[model samples]
Target: MQWIHNYQLFLFDFDGLLVNTEEIHYLAYKTMCANRGINFNWDFETYCRIAHYKSEGLSQKIYAEFPELYAVEPSWEVLYGEKKKAIIELVSNGAVQLMPGVSSLLSALQKANIPRSVVTHSPVELVSAIRSQHSILNTIPYWITREQYSHPKPNSECYLKAIQLLAKPEDKVIGFEDTPRGLTALLGTKAKAVLVCQIEYPEIPAFIERGVIYIKSLDDLANTQL
Candidate 1:
């Protein structure tokens, strides 16, 4: 049976959850660092954590790790902006691949006539690419990106905005996210959160206490009645 027996809408995150483009993003980040002579030798865990931010935010995060560089480098902003633009271009060219179960899961939702939308920190350019490449993009009409909100994920702005768009705030509105930051942003929106992990990450006991549900695969959700 599904987690929710009845829900008004469903919302999802694109990168890691819907598409396997996260690695491409990491590669772009590494390339950007190399071009700028920045030392970003982070392990997988560190990359996954900080990668919660998109290209622009990721650049800031990379800078924040090195205080001295961030302070003295007056040209950091312009340089980073250029790097982020390049990364976005790579993603726009259909380098990112969709995840395995996305097509089927989305098709089911569409057949059921349930309203769904995307809540992501990705910029509009990347979002457009995802939709254009995926034929099921039309299944989701309410797309809310970081630009629309003053605060992005881990802040509840995107989720709340989606709720307003769907015109529902009941517990029926379920959210699916792959990152902890996205899950944090989804908190207290009166929607159930289904975390679709790419790998087995540590469980946040605190978030579980707050009613977030963690799952290993999107296919597993198929068994859910909701």
Candidate 2:
């Protein structure tokens, strides 16, 4: 909690860090496979492991490792598109929920007037969808979404651009991410990077080896009056 105050500018990764959309995303991905008659019955635990795989060094990454998809669709983009569609539908049904302490953390940040922005690869439509249901999210003044950047996570381009726009030369910057892909990118900024997730992804231990700070949730921020 005290560490958060060390930074004057704060950046956050969306989807996992600020919200509990991982479960919704897992459901949406599973639904996409089911709709196409692909029996993608990986339980939540299995889906989480695969979903957290970094798409950084790879192109056209297929989230589902099923052969059934190649037969039904030529492009993996279409699968992701369908997955996005399902996610929006589920979100429309009030499926998305804010992660614990997100509201209090954002409120405290706003109260302190520390400059903050959400740097995410998520589309603006999905961000807006969540905001519609959780108005507390509106406390974030800037959202650097997919449309604003070309390169994604595991590349610092997105975060670099956000820092350039939001940080002053004298301000210490800190960023929060839920996975190694996003955390890798945040580390590139030379800002203090924090990993926040309770899920035990196999990929995470390698990061822990490198001394990445990990937290189960942002609930500690709720204790910060800012």
Candidate 3:
């Protein structure tokens, strides 16, 4: 079996890994659709497929295909900004909870004096809002969000920025993610990534084929001595 090194830094993805907010994001998009007189619902499978695309570009592509729904919009950016704010409010309500084993794992990491950071495709404002609302204050020593880079996830830019911010080599870092796109971003970081399978994503054989180590929960970190 493969092994995780002791005393390594961690880079985490926020949406699915740190909190169960991916569906909240989809609900926020549905709320945005209310403004346009169209009811949009994104299933788990559909959201996963589209989330692999660049963040802002993903929203634009979805919006473009439904021009009839958003015909009255003055600008795409304005619409996107509004939708993102809606999402921030949804998350700020604390309706979404942290995933199982997250707090305990993070607590253990903190007690061990491991440096940790977040590497996410989420916009900086939304990421900060969620973090602050959830009171996840001191777990991260460094944070890298999409706003810090011109390129978004599924690209290596975010992860590269985390490594630079933490001043750690790839081999000395570890990453966690639940989605294929997030995994792609983590793998692009050149760090060993632990693939935490979500209930919505049960049969991800492709992830294993990509050399990702699959775990049922973040508690696996303790077993791996991370």
- Best-fitting candidate, scored by TM-score: 2
TM per model? 0.82, 0.88, 0.82
> Model 1, 30: alpha-carbon shift in Å?
0.8
How do the residues 1-226 of candidate 3 rate in per-residue lDDT, one tens digit apiece? 1232353777888887888777787777778778788767667657666765456666666676677665777476877777787887787777678888887777766667778888777777777777776665457777777778877667778887877777545348778888766778788766777888655454367767777778877766557543
Model 2 clashing residue pairs (backbone): none
Error of 2 at 2 (Å): 5.9
lDDT of 2 by residue, 57-105 (tens): 2213343356667777877677778888999899999988889888878
Poorly placed runs, candidate 3 (over 4 Å): 1-7, 54-57, 64-67, 167-171, 199-203, 219-226
Of candidate 2, the 10-residue stretch with the lowest lDDT total is 56-65
Model 1 TM-score is: 0.82
The order of the candidates by lDDT, greatest first, is 2, 1, 3
Per-candidate clashes come to 6, 0, 0
After superposition of all CA atoms, the RMSD between model 3 and the true structure is: 3.4
